[model samples]
Target: MTISSAHPETEPKWWKEATVYQIYPASFKDSNNDGWGDMKGIASKLEYIKDLGADAIWISPFYDSPQDDMGYDIANYEKVWPTYGTNEDCFALIDKTHKLGMKFITDLVINHCSSEHEWFKESRSSKTNPKRDWFFWRAPKGYDADGAPIPPNNWRSYFGGSAWTFDETTNEFYLRLFCSTQPDLNWENEDCRKAIYESAVGYWLDHGVDGFRIDVGSLYSKVVGLPDAPVIDKNTKWQASDAFTMNGPRIHEFHQEMNKFMRDRVKDGREIMTVGEMQHASDETKKLYTSASRHELSELFNFSHTDVELPSSAKTWSHLN
Candidate 1:
């Protein structure tokens, strides 16, 4: 059996034909030998990557974070993690990669950020604070017999616990789809999305990154009304949140908005590329994500069969439904 292009007349994107090299900066190379990799180390090896016939370099997150979840829990979107190197070092790496004729793609982890991030801090500061709406927060459903506050729903953290973490200061629970240290951002807030696009997406593009590898891309949208995930795992108090959070109601709208914002910043003579790490979305739904007319994504990494997060009983498509 063989497969052919359904749209042979469509223009081929550069990334479609280019070979890519994925780098985890923390352990890739350590220029200063602080026991961790830095931007300078990656920069030093640009020619080596090019020599290997890689047309693009995809670096994992090196953004400012508490490192609770490696760099996935971004603390500051605009700053580089100090051990990784300074902002100057990052810019130089991007410039060096471009001079070598290789595209640079950095991780964009917007689904959730570190609890220590300024946004999350301010959000958890007080319930009435202006930024409180920047993350998902819900009042306790009720108190249990032991007087402990129950989470708003039975959603489980990807790391294996309650998805909602109680905040004593605010008397509310904030959602953390991953770890308690990583608070999911509220994409429903237009202000938050605008600021994120400008600072996180636009700044990198302006400084010379060719594109981004969006992390947990399909989980951007939140399930409306904070519904409980189906109790697929009978033994656990919490269940997988994919049913509510993945490929959410506003997923396409949010992606299109971000895609347009990214495209509008293009200065001509330069083509921007993007690939999203997606999960729990159907093949038909993925078509909407990469459709040029839809302006959602250039490409997407589907985590269906490739995802090791699912249990054996839950791995089948029937279980997902």
Candidate 2:
């Protein structure tokens, strides 16, 4: 499918006509029989990706990580995991992808890092550590009239239980929106924000990657007040408060900063494409995040379609018909 249009200036071209494929790397194929797929495996399969008519390939995370969250909890944003391949292997894959006239995009998870990550380890070391403020922390809400140690709010974690975990050494609670092993970084901290922005985007740009598919992109920033969420349902183990935390207040500002950085660094006028995965975004919210002038994202994946139960709804559909 050629993407040419008569009025090329006004065309919604490029990606619309490009065939793309997602490689889950781990399950794709194992070249050396190491029981895991590595860069060599992907390199060996480049011919197949090209022959299948894919003009671009979106690779799942292969960054240095603990694999606790399947490579989503990046320990080092600048390097590829040894299990995946060396830096040289990544470059070779890039060369191969480009040789076939196909571009490559990688997954970038910015919301949190593995507990083993240097930033998180140092942040949790002491209350007075310089990096402590790099992550969200709070003193245990001290005392009701009855003198009980209250939590900051009624925020529940996505994995289950409280979102705040107490650190006995520091005598405070650190916020982790997801797994305890994956600590959420404080985007409000300029240093933290700058570090993540540079590391995540710079690595790929340096490696000649075309773009990124930002995982949980909207979950980067949080509301300042950290207020309690009202109860929605008693039967559900999860709380409605999860929504307030997912796409928080300052997310747009963070994205704008990232967008500007990418735009400034683009080589030879090539546009840096970005796709955001936001869990509960509405159509208006999606438009706000992906608006061309806003420079937040090139596109966003909406979760509305997955919320439907087709088989159960078929009876209702029959009645309506």
- Per residue, candidate 1 scores C-alpha lDDT tens digits across 118-229 of 8888999998988899899999999999999999999988777899999999789999988899999999999999988998898888898888988889888887798987
Regions more than 4 Å wrong, model 2:
6-10, 142-151, 236-238, 309-321
Window of ten residues with lowest summed lDDT in model 2:
312-321
lDDT of 2 at 149: 57
lDDT per residue as tens, model 2, 119-193: 988998998888998988898877578865556677777666778777777777888777777888988899998
TM-score, each model? 0.93, 0.89
Clashes of each: 0, 0
Candidate with top lDDT is 1
Quality of model 2 by C-alpha lDDT: 0.79
RMSD of each: 4.0, 5.3
Model 1 weakest 10-residue run by lDDT: 312-321
